[model samples]
Target: MTYADVFRAEWGQVVATLIRMIGDWELAEECTQEACAAALERWPRDGVPDKPGAWLTTTARNRAIDWLRREAVGAAKLQEVAAMTDEPPPAYDVPDDRLRLMFTCCHPALAMEARVALTLRTLAGLSTAEIARAFLVGETTMSKRLTRAKQKIQYAGIPYRVPPAHLLPERTPAVLAVLYLLFNEGYSDVSRSTLSQEGIRLARLLVELMPEEPEAAGLLALMLFHDSRRETRLSPDGVLITLDEQDRTRWNCELITEAEELLDRTLQRHMPGPYQVQAAIAACHAIARTAADTDWPQIAALYGQLPQTPVVALNRAVALGMADGPGVGLALVDQLATGSLAGYHLLPAARADFLRRLNRRTEAVAAYTEAIELATTDADRKYLQKRLVQVSVQS
Candidate 1:
């Protein structure tokens, strides 16, 4: 493979392994960058090796040894390097190292915003601008958040290894949140690039890295259920189509089946964690042959049990509307309006939907206009603006 292709495929593995070896996330990232730079210069001439990942790993290892020899010159670390001379060095294939990195990047010890910005930057290769767009924040603010998160890690000495299995259950929810955030960052059209494929890739990687973890399985299932409907979310004219308006024939049956099987297996574990419940909610939609056929009542029930994350409650309210009536959904949306979600776009959007259903055209148009003002993406703005137009014409 070309150097570019090789680096893209193997960069995460090399960086993850280096972080494990060096016990410093920032320095390991630097060493990997330096190694990739060296490979670019040398590989075209020396020719790419058959095992490029191993080649890159060895190059980075040697670079780290050289740095430590000059700076640290310690006894134990020096002995560790010397021991590495006789062997090709073990494959960087430690299980769950990536998961460990995810937790570190999104440690709750860090600010919630910082956790998200750092995870996307370090794990998914997302830029500050891209992350900012995801949350409707300025790029400068996102950059600061990322920088602060890294500093916190450096100062707090967050370990680069996964916690012991006995501690896994306590920590698993945080790990799942990281993966979910990662998938969401990519699943939506927050950037010029379509991250849907990338989201699927990262989800698969996390599940592969932590095969025995039920939360990881739930993560994969959650992503699969959403991904199955990606194509159906857009019209040929590039308009955003609501799920109830989407054509079920466009959904990916294979992905749906895979996610269903995962949901079944996840249920056997029966810890009923947040991700497991979210996946079950998605499964309700996946099993339906049509939007009207969806089990909205079951979805509403799952959402009721979902964690107290505001987004979860907001989503549950939408399902409640579909399952019950606009009154129930509107009450929930109205309740959140005075709470933490006062300025959030989805609240207004949900309010608009309920108003429209009740034939309150003026209020619906105003709510849609507020949603449009709050929207970040051009796609979302256009969607809300169009809804306003429709309501105005009807009025």
Candidate 2:
């Protein structure tokens, strides 16, 4: 059971280390996966090893050694890999190699989607399916994308290390975007919480490494605020709980406080960005003592400050609907029904809520049905199913 957690935390390190050593992404992955399979078979009988990462790394190294011998790549390289031996890397203390690999994966040579997807796949060990869900695409589509990205790296001879200091500015934004997307995956899904925590951990490292970057701090604050309520986001029966219905008393005050303090420092920088504005919106909900106390008008105004992407427009619509009247919100929501959010469940979910609030029970029922039909997670489906029943009876 604990091995699963260790694997999530260590998989990236093992893979990254092997890639660094052998310079073959595919072979490193295969050997590390083989090492994982070996652990599953042995750990239960032999008991969990004291140093799992070291054990796995050594096992993987030996596997690589055997592989190189069979492949007959080169005598010198084979001797080199075989001769390498030392203390295994630490489990958690600021993995430089993994960070280097992250920057490498975020190289501008690849498409933005491919860079983020590849980084999540290689550095975080997230499944292609998980990354696909985050991207709102099919698993097969993402698999091909990942395969192509890796092939691009291999054939194009992109270096697998961090960029120089001068090049960091251009790549930093992409890196931040990847981290934010990673955290959101965790935030929206319960099963991937470890990935979410990894997102936070890496964000903290980025902030520490680049304290001058206010947006990095802002991103970290955003993650903390959302992660604070993780425990209360679901009911005992695994039903999704909306933010308004969440038990605020059970929220982690410490994380919220840390986030607020961090955001305050970020604000002092006087260079507000999209992440800062979004963090400010999260702050409003966090500071409110009750759902009724939430500053919907202020939140709506904050959302207005952001660039009006389809997702942002949808969020603004919800905030406006909450701040003004249901009519105002429903109008905005409806305008987006045919655009980029055509099949997105949240759009219909928001429409259903506004209609429900307006007592348009029949319309609400239909909207809820659409939302539930499109929803992916069981938690979302269950919550929408409950809403559908309520609206149907009312109609």
Candidate 3:
């Protein structure tokens, strides 16, 4: 990897380790930024270090210490360092600390929005503006949320350590949910800035750091299974392409194989968690040679057995429509439309597609128009517009 790439890759580790040592999330974040600035200035002539992660950490630590010394107010921080002066610095190689950082950022004491903003800023390397745009909010709002989150972390004395194994069952699911939210934020056009690439990258990181965690593995597999279709999910003109209409030949076979293997292994562990079940459903699609070959019945059955989340149910309904008919999918979509998802554009978007399939052009056109009106992002709006056009022309 190039130096820039290396810096980006090590950014989370550097920030995470500093947060552990400094016990101040905002200060650590600032120190990490300062360290990167210093690296940019010096690395060209000093050359990359043998262990860049350690180099960044030590450099950030020294910078923080120097600032504290100058201020003459960090007696406690200084004393803590002095007490540990003889000991070798803790290794940043364990890598699980980054995941721990995620848990810390998403701690329930903070508001959910704050957790998301802070997680994106600290762990995911997203800028405040980038995060604001993802959430369809103004930058100032996102900035305040992040600031409050960091302040809360400091005031609440939130420890930067992974929860214990006994506590894992209860807490780890929240961590998985955050990552899942992160993945979807990137996967969907609504929030994605990078080509679902960020989501895939983050999911891969989770699996790498927590290889034994079945949910992490399952989530990674699920992302890959769906991401393999990214190239064909949109047309050249950026219109949304339904799964059955997508060119299966363009799917990434290698990713499909890997996802299948991961799903198989996860299934054998005998842990029938939400992610594994979802991965199993995606696996049915991966195994299909052609759209016609997709075992819609099996997918529908898996959806029935899967845990009840609105998004999962929504997806299952879509699959059922494809597997069974628009009547089944429309029924589910209608229920969603009547309730919490009233403002959600995808509900209408999905309804439009199913309506079009059912030759209900007038209703399809109206649904597509509603989706376009509710769309938050330019890409999604454009996609909905195109759908509206197609249905209008058909009518």
Candidate 4:
């Protein structure tokens, strides 16, 4: 694999190892970046190392040892890092060091948003700006939050490992939230698709680690279902492709089947949670022979089972429109508390779609224009622009 490919595959493992050795989040990250950069520059000359992960861990740990010695923090820390081998010994039975780190980062003491943001930054190697955009916040704001979170971990001495089995029940929700947000960030942004893939990989690890946790299985199914369509979400020219317009023939059937079977297995446990419910909804779409065959009413019912957040409510409205008529959908969308969904581009985009369906061409054009303005990503903005042009012509 190329240096870039190797970086994506092993960044988390290398970071986890350094953190375990140095016990400094910032140092581990910085040294890991330096080690990866060294690889990028030197690999072409020296040839990619046969064991890039080992090479990276040695390079980064050595850097950390050097930094610690210069600062003279403690002989023990220097000795600890200096004596590290390629692999850091796990304190417990955690299968992967990265998973151990994720649980620590998602400690319940941190605000839910802070937990998700910190884990994304430390484990997935997302830049502060990238995490900020994912959270819909300014870069400076996210930077401060991350700083505070790490400080909290340091000062409070959050254990850098999986919680005890007794604590896992309470902490499981927060850990799941981190993975969900990480996956969502990846799913939304093409540039960071690797984050989504990493999220999936980690979720799989969680499922293995806790076989009885239905929600973990539920989450994995949800990710696989969503990722199955990744190839079709954007067109060749990079314009967004709506579900109905995507080519079913090219969808990843293997992923869909895996997700569906997993969801089925999890549902049999009879512990229905939001993730399972949402995965079931996704499965409805996946099983449809065509867009025309989608079970909108069933999907709408599944949406109703979820907590009625503004986004969920908006989606339910869309499903209602599809199941009933655009008029019903438009009415529900309009009935949402005004300003509750303010500045959420999808709200306007949903309105535009419902309006378009109702042949309210003038309203559709205006809504699409508004959505285009509010849209954050280029693909979304382009898709709205296309819709605006179509509706404008119709009007």
Candidate 5:
């Protein structure tokens, strides 16, 4: 594999391993970057190593040891590192270090946005620019947020280890939420495929670590269900394709079946959370052989069980529109337009669709114009622009 691929795969594990050994986030990150730089310089000449992760970890650990010895502050920590370096790497069925780092980054003490940003940065190895673009924020803002989060972790004495069984109930939700957001950000944009895959990988790790946590399984199932449609979500020309317009034959049936089985297993646990409910809604779409066969009423009912965030409410309005009528959906969309969702692009987009369905071409044109203005990504903007043209023509 190319050194770039190795760096992407191993950066998190190497940093996590060093952090666990040295108990310093900044130092571990610094040393890991140094190791990556060194690899970039040397690997092309010497050829890729068989065990790149092990090589990177050893290099980073040595750098940490050198720093510790020069500082002479933590002899005990240095000795521990030396001892670890002397021993061969263990062949484990799972790596707990990365999991521990994920939980640490998603600690409840951090702000929700900070938790999501930090997890994407540290655990998923995403650059600040990539993350900023994903969330529609400035790179400087994301950099500052990450810096403050790391400082909080250091100063507030947030433990780096995973929470105990008793504490899992409290801590797991934040972690799951961060992962879910990460997945959604990646899933929404075609250019961010790596981020989506990383999110899925982490979700799978969470399930493996906490087998009894049905929510973890539910989150994984939810992502898988969405991922099953990834190939058909966009056209070959990179234009966005709405769900109803996507070709069902291109959908990954294997992933859909797996997600269905997983959601079924999680539901049998008898505890339904937001992810499980969302997964069920996704399953409602996945199981349908054709767009007309989709169970919109069931999907709308499932949305009712979810907390009424503006986004959920917007989606519920769409499902209600499909199940009931465009007038019903338009009323709900109008109500949201006056609320916190006023500036949201999808709010206007939904309004435009409902208006179009009712043949209120003038209102649809206005709403589509607003949606085009608010849309973030080029694909979304292009799609909205296309819809705007159609509605304007009708008007």
Candidate 6:
């Protein structure tokens, strides 16, 4: 693999290991970056090492030890680092350094937003600017958020290891939520593909580490199901394609089959969670040969089982509209319009579709215009703009 690839794949593990060894987050990050830079300069000449991860770890740990020595930070920690250097790298195992790092970054003590941001920055190795752009915030804002989060971790004495067995049930949800958001952000905007893939990779690791956790498998299944349709999500001209309009032939059957298998395994456990419910909904869509064949009723029922967040309620309304009538969906949309979903683009977009289906051209046009104004992503904006033009002509 190229040096860049190695750095991307191993940076988090190296940092996590160094943090565990040296108990200094900043020092770990600094040493990891230096190790990566050294690899970039030396690998082309010395050739890639037999074990890139081990090589990087050794190099970074050595750097950390040197820094510790220079700082004169007591003999105890220095002795720890010196011993770490002497020991051979352990064999690859189920619960790797990255998984431990994920749990640590997603600690419940951190705010939910802080958990997501720190996971993306530390585990996924995304730049502050990249993360800022992904979340549609300014770079300065994201920088401060990350800095504050890291400071909190240090000052609050948050342990860097994975939670104990009793704590896993309570802690895993936050980690799963962070992964879900990371994948969603990437899925929504093609520019953030790395985040989506990183999310899947980490989710897979989580499942491997905790096979008894059905929700972990469910989360992975949900991501795989969504990823199966990635290629068909947009048209050649870069306009967003609704699920009904997408060419099903272009969908990745392999990923769909794998996701189904995962869902089946999780269902066998007889423990349904939000991720499992969402995965089942995705599976319902995947198994359908055409949009008309989709099990909207079943999907709606699945959504009903989920906690009624504004977004879930909005989605349920759309499914209800499809299964019942546009009027049913429109009534639900109207109820949400004055609530917390007032400014959400999808709420108006859903309203516009329901109105258009009911042949209320004037109302549809208005809703489409509102949706266009609030649309966030380029794809969403383009799709809404197209809908606006069509509805305007009809009006």
Residues 1-395, model 1: lDDT tens digits: 45665775566667766665666667767777889999989988998988887888788888888888889767786666445432333334324445556654555577676766676666665666767766656778777777777777778887755545455555556556656666776566634233456556656766675677777788789889998998777666667788888888889999999999988887896687777888888888888878789998899888888766677788988889988999889988888887657667888999999999989999999899999888756777877888899999998
Runs of candidate 5 with Cα error greater than 4 angstroms are 1-7, 27-97, 108-114, 127-145, 162-170, 338-344, 360-378
Task: Tell me the TM-score of each prediction against the true structure.
Answer: 0.73, 0.89, 0.72, 0.86, 0.79, 0.75
The lDDT of each candidate is 0.74, 0.86, 0.75, 0.84, 0.83, 0.84
Candidate 2 residues 130-156, lDDT tens each? Answer: 788677677899999998988898899
Q: Per-residue lDDT of 249-336 in model 5, one digit per residue for the tens?
A: 9999998988888889989876799999999999999988889999999999999999988789889999999999999999988888
**Model 1 TM-score relative to the real fold:** 0.73
Q: Model 3: clashing residue pairs?
A: none
RMSD of each: 5.4, 2.9, 5.3, 3.0, 4.0, 4.7
lDDT, model 3: 0.75
Quote model 4's TM-score: 0.86
**Candidate 4 Cα deviation (angstroms), residue 264:** 2.9
Q: How would you encode candidate 3's per-residue C-alpha lDDT over 1-395 as one tens digit per residue? A: 56666666677777776676778777777888888888888889999888887778777887778777887857898776434332333444234555656765666677677766777677767678767755656779889888888888888888776655455445556567667666666666633535256566666776775678888889888988988887887767766676777888999999998998888887788676778888888888878888889998888888888776666678788888887799989988888766546666788989998999999999999999998987866768877887788889989
Query: Model 3: runs farther than 4 Å from truth?
Result: 1-18, 26-73, 78-89, 103-117, 126-152, 162-171, 189-212, 376-378
Residues 262-381, model 4: lDDT tens digits: 999989987789999989999998998799999999999999999987789989999999999989998998987384577678988999998898888888888998899978788898
Query: TM-score of model 5 relative to the true fold?
Result: 0.79
Assess candidate 1 and give its lDDT. 0.74
- Cα deviation at 174, candidate 1, in Å, is 3.7
- Roughly what TM-score does model 6 have, to 2 decimal places? 0.75
